[model samples]
Target: MELNDKIEKALHAEQKDHEISAGWRLILASALGIGFGSVGFATYAIGAFIDPLGKEFGWSRAEVQGAIAFGVGLGGFAAPIIGMLIDRYGGRSIAIYGLLGVTVGYLMASTAGGNLCYFYLAYAAVAVLGAGSGPVSWTRAVAARFDRRRGLALALTLSGTGMAAIVVPPYAVLLVENFGWRVGYVGLACLPLFALPFVLLFFFPAKSGPAAAAAAPVSTDAASAPPTGLTLKQATSSYRFWLLLFSILAMYLGITGIVPNLIPALTDKGFTPSAAAAVQSVYGFSLIVARLGIGWLLDRFWGPAVAALVLTSPVMACLILIGEPNYATAIIASALIGAAAGAELDLLAFFTARYFGIRNYGRIYGFLYTGVAFGAGLGPVAFAYLSDLTGSYNASFQGALVLFALGGTSILFLGRYPNLSAETRPANH
Candidate 1:
């Protein structure tokens, strides 16, 4: 009887550890939700609209890109609040409602005529409504379900952005080319609806309740027990949190700046819109590869070291883009930039889990993501403004080079991940 009990206990433990096998449905749903979510869809699709909106409204590139900066940066301010909500209420209702709001926001954008305020307002609506649909909610859900495979799971989930990158650029370009740009916005708006059924079906296991059970459903033990880790106050006091925050901010500034402008820059250099979008597609492919590859590397290696190596690729990409490069050169530069962009989000999520644990993961990650949103929001406008002032993108690319170097180097000082099992004790530097 004792031997039989031991065998039963061992079997239960083995079943509980089956991360991917037990939770593949949830993972698939997360990837789909994130791919169509605000971060993936809005980020990739906005670039296609920049030139079209500018031409239609007689606006400058900076003026056109300003809407994104305004909406995303301001919307990002709500992340900590949204994070708190996810912590209390769960991500399912938040993500679903957020996606619906985004659809309405995009419809508002499609109705824009010559009023820049209306355009900005439309985007602001998207950002505000869509905040819950971003990584903070989605990653929190995925983190609760995996431990040994956490890095890979996050990589898979974040690959949605990569998938968005692949699909959105060419698709948006096609819509603008055939249909009017107004119609283009409508087409983009419809994408979030497609993910709704998936989210409803697979986002959480049926047995999970709100809060703790909803956030964590890997097993009965995990579902019933409260999560362990530092609170928001505890996490913010650490230099590591601040370091990760600013490092991500700097990286996004350079990356986000380049991506929106890439289409215009290529077209300026004599590539057709179709050709420019193809290069962007290459960048998207690199994103998928990097997300998976970097996630794998983070699992096996020190994350900061992996981050340093990945982030520095943009410097070389910047150097290439500063000059008049050929088709092949443009592809190479795009791929390098894509690699860094791909790695950054998952790295942020992975670091948050490893350093802080999952107890207050939503709020901590949300606050940190605010910096990312600002950098992303600001990068495009800054790049466009620099181009308008200097008559070239060279100045902007040069500035990105500096920011990338600074961002990559800052994380090297983050040292090592603390053992969060001991997080109840004071955090030592």
Candidate 2:
């Protein structure tokens, strides 16, 4: 047998006894879906009560929005550290603990009586929990488990965010309208607590099958690196790390920050609140459609081919917005934007694995998540501030269009790099 053939056999032997078991994938997906769905309810649903909270508490808009910033800021601090922990320990323990934090935060929030500190505490607590339960935990786990279908698994795991976006808003609206904000908060608080019991029951490493099983040490030769992970310091030192960082910043900057702000921007363009909301729903629904569609494509196409297709979506959305058409135009834009948002999360995870080895994935992914936090945290507030300055949504929307196009252009370069799985480095040497 040729030397390369021997290398292939050794790697194949690593997979002889274990593989990512289907049952485990289902459990992880369910845990992610529920945990993410609950957090989604807690985060996005708060908008429904913004007016009511302000009216009752007499707080200014800045003060109210400040609570959101506090939460995001706290997340920025917790996520990277948690990632390091996940790299050192494992994902299951952190996920369970994080869910418990969210439950406690929301429970405290349910009893809050107009005290700003109380609201801040609740939001901050949830932020800490977010580090453990969000994409950083589950997506990394899925990526580590599946190689050929890694992209699809990531898409499935992250589809949780879309699921939350789809279900939470309306549920929150109904809760606030019928039962009152206090009752709504209590219900939301209970969701994380409820999720905790199930995660403890089914989310286990043994369930992940072979991928989670301990492997022998990697050899020094070209053929040796195992599919699992590395220490945090070793991960950061690689050239692949920088590539992943730039890729994330290029793609994530506009998408995470701009899409949420689209809700208010559409309303500003003469659409009624209900019509604007419907448009938002269209965008959220697109995520569900796009993720499934992209997952299918990832299994068959090269990563960049699928990536380019996904990147085009935001450009289409921006074009629709610039056209300044009627409600139908707005809805179309929303759908495209939704698709782009849906695909980015999975693609980012794919990019990380495609560019970097899966060993040390948690820390590397956590660092990447920090960039996501920066984009998500700053995007809406920056857009809102720009709207105030420009006195129009069109100008702000146009700015987003430029950024979206730039992100699309970046994906074209991805095809030029050597496949990380092959153990060859990019020519940037």
Best of the candidates, TM-score? 1
Query: Relative to the true structure, how large is the alpha-carbon lDDT of every model?
Result: 0.85, 0.63
TM-score of each: 0.92, 0.80
Q: Which residues of candidate 2, in runs, are more than 4 Å off?
A: 1-43, 58-63, 112-117, 206-240, 269-275, 322-325, 389-392, 415-429
Please write out the lDDT profile of model 2 over residues 264-350, one tens digit for every residue: 566567775455556666766888789878876876777676776777667767777766658888878877877887777777777
lDDT of 1 by residue, 11-95 (tens): 7668545776778888888888888877676767777888888787899999988988998887789888888888776788888
Query: Cα lDDT for residue 165, model 2?
Result: 63
Of the candidates shown, which would achieve the greatest lDDT relative to the real structure?
1
